[model samples]
Target: MNETIGAAAAGPSDIAAAAGRLTRAAASGVPCAPVRDLIGRDDLAAAYAVQAALTATRLAAGARITGRKIGLTSEAVQRQLGVDQPDFGVLFEDMAYADGAVIPAGRVLQPRAEAEIAFVLGSDLADGPLDARQVRDAVEYGVAALEICGSRIAGWDISFGDTVADNASAGAYVLGTERRTLEEFEPVDVVMSMSIGGQEVSTGTGAACLGDPIEAVVWLARTARDLGEPLRAGQVVLSGALGPMRPVTAGDTVTATLSGLGTVTAGFTEGAAS
Candidate 1:
């Protein structure tokens, strides 16, 4: 897999070294330098290879895959990165937090929060054209979600490959309780308002997510399937951000409300020394 990544530009040793750097950063609660020098910027396959290595280690340690999260869904961001499509990260069971739960500050490095629509899949999306209809039909319900993003790369300075290798800067997530079927609510029609410490900080409509959040899922379904891991039943899909991501600090309370999907909140605690 490493040899195939980036057409062998980043070999097995390179992938291992990159993964080791990120693992240490996460373990020490200290951000590390970018891995682009090792993996090469724009080498997406090499970056994903690094991410896969880390994920494999985690799974070996008993962590389980829960779902996936889409990133770079913003058209502006895509243009800035010279890419037309978004990237994705694997979600682990340990990365999920209950709505209203207080997250430990030390659990993530340089955390940020963004509002998103969480789609809980009711069926497999392993085959077919994976069009908008197939993606929507596979959804069991939609709920408001808070994605707590963090970067292991120091100062959040990253190139495309850097962020991808860092698992799309994924940290954790909170899912709302209210579940509305596709018929009950249209994803592109919902508006989002997110506040921290009772102050509005981010706001956007579902259209901000690749024109529609469902479209993001369609892209993800195809991408994941092509990569050999297809979207399956009961896995939650975070359909990219509905708005800008805001930096989060210890003790900050994040609350996001999505029209039709309801609200979700996450609290940050004063961290313990890591």
Candidate 2:
């Protein structure tokens, strides 16, 4: 929208590597002012073309497609973003960490914690009216997850394009034990609690995510359809964050509980051992 961004809108290459560089920057917790400067460019459409190209780069690198994440999926977040709804981003195998794992802090530019519900897909989902039952039926199980969001754009007010190009600030995440399926339990009505180093931090209900976490899953299904990248079987879709997001630091321990769903834990380390 700005004059500078107006010029970037015409740059084809801008879209090609924006997301990838932003991803790399976020993972390493480094400044990416170069990318941030192009936000709101009139050249954004072509830039997104370039940004979308990175999807092929990841696929070519043997990074398996896992699922997608719906971010800002709440009225509160929408207000924060000055938008009506939320946005979504792609997820790959490289962004995942098993439960009880110690995350290498060196990889993330700036790490933050968010509580989420993950839905493992049962079949392919494409554009169409979303059904709560279909989402419930497709759900294999639920896990308590910690979404490690990061950013590399120094100090900037990210526009929709900026956030999207940064892979929604997705750094890494941890998945906990499974807790049946949506059909077997109330995934959206649960009361959740989170702790850091054995200290209570946030509390909320699954309703915090667009009223129902399943609805969040449904939202992802429809969004992917719009993007021509619908959900596929075996893909795990992570719902939006519940409660407030917490920042991560070296040597910190985090544990999140989803009432009936169980718990997930992650530890942060300065770097890989020598």
Candidate 3:
């Protein structure tokens, strides 16, 4: 598995070293290549392995695993990335901010926003080949979530591998006002709508997420287990998006209205204060 990643000029060590550099940049507000150089490798498995390692380092360093995020799920985003599928990543607890929390957007490199449905896990999920039933059983609540997508990519040329390693471009997330119980809302039939700056931008139904979000959660958990980072209890998983991702800038306010759950809003740091 690693030999494939070694095909890159940087090799495994170089790729691993780049991870440290990435952490430093993210912490110190400096900038560097965002796993794109590693993505140039011809082997898909290798690139993904590098991402797993990068994510593992954060976990080992005490980063709390909160939930999972699935990107490129929308057909439009799939076309933009030149892929017909979605990529996934883990969201850390510290990365979650309550709605209305002032996000110092300056720290982000080209931050954007996307509203998504967030699933709160009630129990640890370590099952292999996990099914939608398991996901449903493990989830205790659902809420509207807003994912703030920040990327180190100067241009929008990032590939699936690059996005994957960058944690699906996840920087921060916002939880909405209400928590809906599974019994209250049949997640499979819930509708969702997203608006940016008061203008509707993305919309779809809960069914858009691979029939039901629980299915996406099942896939994420089983897949993460295959990668060696099984889902943990209390993690907030942002299922796939209901629609395409829109570009957001400073001062932009965004909200996602989830039928069963409610709404969550996050405002980008205003220019002078951004």
Top-down TM-score ranking: 1, 2, 3
Residue pairs whose backbone atoms clash in candidate 1 = none
Model 2 C-alpha lDDT per residue in residues 83-164, reported as the tens digit of each score: 6656666788878999999998865656788888887777777634657777777777887888887666665456656666
Pairs that collide, model 3: 66-235, 66-236, 67-236
lDDT, each prediction: 0.92, 0.72, 0.72
Model 3 agreement with the true structure over 166-229: per-residue lDDT tens digits: 6677777889879887888887787878888899998888777776777777767776776667
Q: Write the per-residue lDDT of candidate 1 for residues 1-274, one digit (tens) a residue.
A: 0122235478889999999999999988889999999998878888999999999999999999999999999998888877677889999998999999999887878999999999999999999999999998999999999999999999998888898999999999999999999999999999999999999999999999999999999988988887889999999999999999999989899999999988999999987433
Displacement of the residue 99 alpha carbon in candidate 1, Å: 0.9
- Residue range with the least summed lDDT across 10 consecutive positions in model 2: 1-10
- Model 1, C-alpha of 59: deviation from truth (Å): 0.5
